[model samples]
Target: MRFSWLLLLPLLAACNSNPSAERGEPGFGAADPESPADATALPAPDTASTKAVSAVSDTLRTVRQKHNFSNPKGPADLFKLVYRGPSILDGTGEFTITNPTGEVIFREMLTEPDLEAALVYEMKNPTATRAERETYVLRRIDRFFVPSQFHTPAIDPNAAFPTGLETLERATWDDLQHRPDAIGFDYLKGKEDRQRIAWSPLTKQVVRVQ
Candidate 1:
């Protein structure tokens, strides 16, 4: 899938606005007893401050290659690597996979388990392209994936949020807007859309859209 350069506008805006967005979290691994259980229970050491995290990521890939996980076959198999922007302290992120026609298959915030699974899948499948690998890697380091257990379900009488990772799955595009620094991705070909989206903490409405 080819993408126009215009797709990058939102990402560029995010990058320029926060130069340190990619740095992960400061003192991410430092012990903090006062931190919430959600904060301390992270799957892996924060990637921003250490090369070891990258090394571990690579090893996981190698193992997955040895096992031969399959490449995504359709929209259902497709996964979107989402990053919440710089405004949030933890740089929350998500993994969303949609079907070929653009229906969401699954959405999970990046957690240690989710990242490990994604990395292994990318490594095992020879058909998985560079773009896919890069997207996975970027999400791995960006600190976007938060454990789903942290969020309380917004009040709605009709639907019940799925438990575990499924809890991270969002029910609508409107939900995506609520996320800080929300960015969308096409994992297979490495294309990204929804470049113009910003959330207003004050008004709680999508403040910007492109």
Candidate 2:
């Protein structure tokens, strides 16, 4: 009787495992073992670099907007904008001004051979006829902020020159040479006051301001 009971135990367990026949309902967890299906799998993708770039971009925008200036470039990109001077000792380049992203936002290369001529032409062709040429000329002259003494002999401030007129560029030399009120050329010998108090277009008066 014990051996017969042991043989019947296997049959009882198998019937219990079948929910549809043993219980009143079908088993939810049961699946056909022989069912055919496609296996779902994919190659693991590398996202490290993509994530890094996104993080850097976010940080860059936040930093640039803090200053009034827009989209300033990173140090590497800034260095790439080689001045290739005659640029003022101040690092003002003759060619291009770029943002942090390597985009050229401003360019001074209006013409070849003569940068001053290009500046004069731009001044002469004022956006508004009512605007004075002197204002534009002064503004453009300020762009040539190189700290080293004038490279060309024609513009040497040291050479005997008139007062009030400062440096003797060929242009200024021609205008002030015959004038009696001319102060002294040596006045221009000092560091150029790029921010010198001059007439203000916005105020329309000689304001003692930048």
Candidate 1 TM-score to native: 0.21
Model 1 agreement with the true structure over 1-210: per-residue lDDT tens digits: 237667887788876654333443445444454578747676775769664434333322111001000112221224345444332222334555444455544444543333434465447665556566556655554433233211222222343443433313344434644443343321221222212222223343322222
The alpha-carbon deviation from the true structure for residue 201 of candidate 2, after best TM-score superposition, in angstroms, is 19
Off by over 4 Å in 2: 19-99, 102-210
The residue-level lDDT of candidate 1 at 101 comes to 54
lDDT of 2 at 59: 22
lDDT of 1: 0.38
Instruction: Kindly provide the TM-score of model 2 when superposed on the true structure, using C-alpha atoms.
Output: 0.17
lDDT of 2 at 10: 89
Among these predictions, the greatest lDDT belongs to: 1
**Total clashing pairs for each candidate:** 10, 9
